[model samples]
Target chain A: MCELDREIRRWRRQEMRRSSLSPRELDELEDHLRARVELELELDARLTPARAFAIARDGLGETSVLSREFARAGAVRWRRALGYGWALFALSFLLPALRFEFTHEPVQVLSLTGYEVFWAAVTEGGFRHALCNLAMLLTLPALWRGRVRGGRWLAGGIGLMGLYLLATGLSLPRGGGGFSASLQVGYLVWAASFVCAAVGLWLRAREWVPTTAERPEA
Target chain B: MKKPVYKELVAASSRPMVLSILAGGESYGYEILKQVKVLSGGELEWSDGMLYPVLHRLERDGLIAGRWELTDEGRRRKYYRLTARGKRQLARDRVSWRAVHGALEMSWGGGHV
Candidate 1:
């Protein structure tokens, strides 16, 4: 509300637009700066508010270096979260994810685990689908390493695969031998992995977004 | 009043120092910096901004947990406390530090080699 506080707010806004740090990080840094500014003022009664603020900010280090350090730390955190997602995805395969029900006289029923469906897709005419799955799997490592291109590719892959899964899960697919395939509980769990990856990527992207106004460097 | 000459040593020791401080209780960034200065007798020189990244790393590694709380003055401040994992890490770190300290003490006591 005061003049110095307004100046600090302006500085925070500029840093937020220019740096990759999240708003929470900017807030934390702002709090630290304010504390240091107060201490500076206390140490030297002759120092003006602006001078105190400048001294405190300088002691906090350059924004460029701080941003770089935060980016590195964020990458490690994101990679760890992605690793857990990949583990969940890998484990989903061992669960029965689909059920095949025959409308024949015997009313026979068959169930396939995620692993079976994966292999079935590979050997069957769904080779293209298998390739898509493999490509999505490959994107995991690249995305984990915080590569922008990998994040984009993985987002696209998740979108396409999610749509495909949703469509298939919502409708009973009629195949040969009067059999209809319905998604089971395990299938939903497998689909949850996509949700996990999507959320992780979304959070990572949310961490850095520049404002439209290009304020000149402070 | 002598500033540490070795930047690497300062950086390496920061983690253990912070862990030991947090082991006493939860504290915020400015308070932690103050404690570090006091504990080091003003010998440990650290830029105010350098501590956040280290804290973030510690939080990410599960060594410390950070949470935001409103002070009685209505100021929102982030506080950090050591986790169980961090206590274990501090114990291990203490062993390593003492070993190095003992070696140095024995060598220095002889006043040579």
Candidate 2:
């Protein structure tokens, strides 16, 4: 019974890897798997490896190989997308902070310092930085189009944001001084834009798109 | 007369042949292919790559089950066999096929006369 269960698992893995099984094929496979489990419960001696293999080889038709290939391709696509998303998120948050630090501008209040400074930066510098980040986040939607389009938009957005962040940090007032009224307004716009872009991108990610190859016609 | 079409052979033998082969004993991938070829007198040919997916579907359907075992030869092989449900299914399939065959023969005006 244990051996039979192991074989069933092996077959299931193989099926997952093959990926080309039609809905009917998948249904049939599930049925067969269940039958095996039932037979195990019954402790049937007829459920030998030799016999099971014969049934599988003969009963399963020609499309099995295609299904396996499709499944493998899908797994690869999912892993790639997940990796991309994580990297993008990390860079989105970390790059701005890094740029502000390296530039060493006096007006840049949001240094790696006390909570007061951090909050000050968010309240004062947050708007401009957020705007730049919002623009960066917008590129995420274009990513849904295709790899090339998404990559282009993401790269362009990130590059522009980086430049803007560097400039803003360098131009900030020093000695705990607040930003000018015009700078504050600009910062608010940037912050609002960033929030909107982030929300939009987050919503877009929820939409289902085929990460794997196109499904075969029935 | 033209040789039996590959499609016709496949369509005709799909279930009965599969069940019959399993009736002998549990067998794995390559062994099943070898047996089928011998049983069909070398006429029925299935590609090696195509068999695994079908096997998976059959396993999925509860008609059959599979397991991996290490042979005395020290190689692990995946084997499959019919469940009780599969046996019952085979019996039903045989009846239906017999009816279809009977109709075809009757329409032809009797057995290979």
Candidate 3:
């Protein structure tokens, strides 16, 4: 690598240390900086390495400013992901297992003993619903984890989720014994959210893409 | 030579401009900035890295999405493209831009009855 490239890389390392962004995000930021530098070089053949680096850095703006923006974006999304994920988790057990034990409701809860509750949870539709919530809950972390380091896995996960949603949406209760319309709509909403999140995550996932020769540090 | 664009206008319009441009097709950061300069006849000068924040925010809001891919020149570039949400956003931006232009024309045009 050239002297300027080394300097740029060192500067990136420093910024990455100070920033809370993930490694993938840091790599992306570096990619952006390099792009600016290359563009500068393309437009001007006579510029010195130091001069070009300065111009590129200046154009990309101060590291702190860019870092702050990325940090904020990451924080906000993580918070949303955590919140949504936890809510699903809490609702799963609270609405089914805990509600059965605490509220004395015989409708949803069949067994008073531990084994009975376990069996009921597995067999009962309400507990099954809660399990679905648990599955949704897992998507949040896996989605982001996949975004950072597992692009192909995330793509496959989302693809499977899409298939599941399609199957569920298609096989709606065609006038069941005790099936409610609102519950059906809830399934649609949950499935739609999953599909939306899956699509968004799939688009952002780049780990599976082959590293180009230009990505020296990658 | 055209005069430099005001910083605030450039900052404010970056989101809509990016969304609108991507609506045309996918492009990387450097290419997008170059297109903006050409489209403005070299009038608008966006602060070098300012668009990154805007792009990040849009992605967070689900307005646009990006991917890192190889170019024909063997350079790895982060390409941005409009998402379905971004398309809807551009439609809104188009209406708002037209309204602003209409207002400006009405204000600057010859006195009307």
Candidate 4:
């Protein structure tokens, strides 16, 4: 991180020590302040970090005023994890994904959760399905941070895979069964999960476009 | 040659102004501030701290919803968007503001200043 970045973080920590503002609120303010500083720096190449930081800080108004405004407005501490929340919600739907029936002998029915199926796939060399799921899971944090380029489409593709699995039952490696497999409600739920993620990511992407586009190249 | 808008008028208009801007889409504090500056052509001056309270109040009234999200640069920002309730409120605000504007236009047009 640059010195200005460190300074901004330190300023946020200092405000947290003395203000009624929640950490999340402070985080918002900090980003606004940092944006102001970036604009200031970009507008004038000769501006020092201290000068730019001061300009941004003062532009944000006093901490006391902000606290009072928040109090008067009845601001409450709240957190939102848009993309992450949707991803986790999607993962939860996998709890009851598949039902297995044995047509041999005494007609037995066995239900398997997504977790069970995942492990079964892993042990049975069903690497393709396992890897796809793993890749989706691994990409979430990056998506949350907006680090993933073309993220909305990536999320949509994940949703499409879930839809494919829903339409066609989970394809696992041959395990010597004389039974047919059908997708359960979990597949549908997972599809909903991914759809939610795609929408959430797209909205997130939309919110930031103008800001980045408006920023003057320095 | 821009005339400064009175602080009272700004305060009175802040709620609808925010609702209207957010109706475009979800936006963060900084971006919203920039929009206000641009749209008003810098005639309306709002302190950065002043807007958050308005946002908080709107949220308290269920006129808007705020969420935290990271920018592509990984900076955390709190984005606010109009709720269904907020849209309805904005519509009502439009009707009232138009009434006021029309009344003023009539008076000004009739040389009543």
Best by TM-score: 1
Between candidates 3 and 4, the one scoring higher on lDDT is: 4
Better of 1 and 2 by TM-score: 1
10 residues in a row with least lDDT, candidate 3 chain A: A94-103
Candidate 3's displacement at residue B103, Å, is 1.8
Interface CA root-mean-square deviation for model 4: 6.7
lDDT of 3 at A153: 60
Q: What are the models' TM-scores?
A: 0.65, 0.38, 0.56, 0.56
- Give candidate 4's whole-model lDDT: 0.72
Cα RMSDs of all predictions?
8.9, 16.8, 9.8, 11.5
RMSD of 2: 16.8
Tens-digit lDDT string for candidate 4 (A1-218)? 38787788788778756665645567767788888888998999999877899899998888877866765684322112345535554574566777777789887888877677667879988886676566467446544333355656765676676567656655543346587565666655655555556555555445434232222234
lDDT of 1 by residue, A1-218 (tens): 27568779888888756665666677678778888888898999888888888898889888878877876664454555555556667776888888988888899889988788878878876675466466557556445334444465566577567557655663347687588787877677666666566656655555444222222224
Q: Tens digits of per-residue lDDT for model 3 on A1-218? A: 37776877787577645543455555666666677767777899888766777787777766666656765654354345434534433332333221122233333422233233335657775464445445555556544433333544654564566568547543333334542222233334444455555544554443233444443235
Give the range of the ten consecutive residues with the poorest summed lDDT in model 1 chain A.
A208-217
Q: How well does chain A score by TM in each candidate?
A: 0.54, 0.27, 0.41, 0.55
Instruction: Choose the strongest candidate by DockQ.
Output: 4
Which segments of model 2 are wrong by more than 4 Å? A1-218, B1-4, B8-12, B110-113
Q: Candidate 2 or 3, higher lDDT?
A: 3
Residue B105 displacement in candidate 3 (angstroms) = 0.3
